[model samples]
Target: MHYAVYFPLVFGAALGLLGPAAATRLPPRPATWLLTVGGLVAAGTTLLVLAILTATLIGGHSLLAGHLHWSPDVFDRSNPVPAVVGAAAALLLAVLAVRTAWAAVRSVVELRQAHRLARTLAPGDGELVVVTEPGPVALAVPGRPGRVVVSAELLRTFDAAERAVVLGHERSHLRHRHHLHHLAARVAAAAVPLLRGLPAATSLATERWADEDSTAQGPRPVVARALFEAAVRTRGAWPRRGACLSVASTDTDVRIRMMLAGPPRRRPLLLLTTVALLTLPVLAGGEALRDAHGLFREAALDAPMHSTPHPTSQR
Candidate 1:
């Protein structure tokens, strides 16, 4: 196979390095979709390349070649993939499969728990549930009818405008289905170790998305102040259970600053370029597959035609 076969793996590592910073810089809504989808695509293409490499190892075996009517000698001579490299690829694929499966299971369990909690909180349509607590707490529970939960203590601390800001932020999470985006990022990270930063980046994007949404009605200062207060009030509060999304769950300081920085500028060029970069892995994978098929076809063509010996007449 051509050296391009390995490009997807290297590209994933490069994406991991750049993705987080890009997630913060871009507009939050687009950034959320880009990071989540990009991670999944990158992980998938990397797996494809690994599978191709693994196949080269097994397909090059003499016994397997005979069954497939392929010439092992020609295959070995033409194969660019080394035996050790193929072995390593196989091992990596197995490890990724186990990790991805475990991550997916955990995500599903957490989401189900969140849904149950939401159902318990509001049996009917979505509504706000205020719980009396010593400290501050707020979270959005996703379900058929999502519920927004807030602590009475936190409500008392916020003025009318800030209160609206907090509610709006959490509501945005439910409306946008941000939890699913997070789950996708989590599984992608598990499948591709190089993309370990993707989940955190997705978290930042979702939080920023909520923050931006909160500013729709009120001034930017109101949203910024509300976020700052939520972070301070819930500084030591225990995290919400399952996949319940909270207004102050991640990068509170950065989000507050971003809110104060004004709306993000529309940079179509950067967004388009990033999207184009995401497709490179998929293209590379296709190229690798084509090259591998050609290699095997050539081997099959070179296989010696053997005439079956006529069976002796039965006595």
Candidate 2:
């Protein structure tokens, strides 16, 4: 509960939100690494504090009893402020640790598979089919091949230029390796649960990020038209699944708005929000520790027990 411990844990949680946000706006290369490091540090700090408190409680209780005797199957438990605070710290650390572990596993599996999948397709003069399914679709799978997959039905959905635009859109996804960003954001969030709000923010940012990437090639209307047409054609699966893992899965309204808006404001708002929110838990934890320590010192010696100073005759 010391400020040292609280600040790190809270800050870790706050930092957790940043990765996803950054993933959306920035490419995965630098941003993902930064977020991943932050999560590791935060989780480590949280676990360290919990471990310390757990050790203190176990040792303190044993010393109080002065022997290792199991209590007789007791149901009622005594309330002690230090013990309660210690327990809470321990629990919080445990949850964060578990989250980190699960996320680590997920990151390794999904991203590796996606990357491997990306290797299967190499875009040439013609398009490819990365995953076998029937629908109007086009998306990028990042790798050396970096597929611009299109379904048979999708080829008939639009004219040649529109088809090219659709392919261009998916190509932009591959160029940016947007799927990797999504995967990293997901993993980082799992690794650090405190940044729960991050995914939504990052998802929004990346859509804008890719929209800008697409517009750099041609007019926004071209990409917009292609997106709308392709989306409508595959309206059924758009709600349920990822089509060939190329299309950047995003909210319809948000993606359309980004296309219309033409890019982000360049404000560091999400990052700033993360920084501001992370400070809170850390402050609370530090204060809690200070208060607990001061209270212990004040109460430990102030209370006086009744004492008979004079020697008494046999009675």
Best by lDDT: 1
TM-score of each: 0.93, 0.61
Across 16-57, the per-residue lDDT of candidate 1 in tens digits comes to 998898778899999999999888988888889999999999
RMSD of 2: 9.7
Q: Please provide, for model 2 over 197-294, each residue's C-alpha lDDT reduced to its tens digit, 9 standing for 90 to 100.
A: 55555455555555556665567877777666666665554223222343445565656665776654554665565446545554555565555455
Count clashes in each candidate, considering only residues at least 3 apart in sequence or on different chains. 0, 8
Q: In model 1, which runs have C-alpha deviations exceeding 4 angstroms?
A: 236-239, 306-315
| Candidate 2 lowest-lDDT run of ten | 70-79
Query: Candidate 2's error at 230, in angstroms?
Result: 2.7
Q: Pull out the clashing pairs in model 2.
A: 3-286, 6-282, 7-282, 17-195, 20-202, 24-205, 24-206, 140-246
User: Which candidate achieves the best TM-score against the true structure?
Assistant: 1
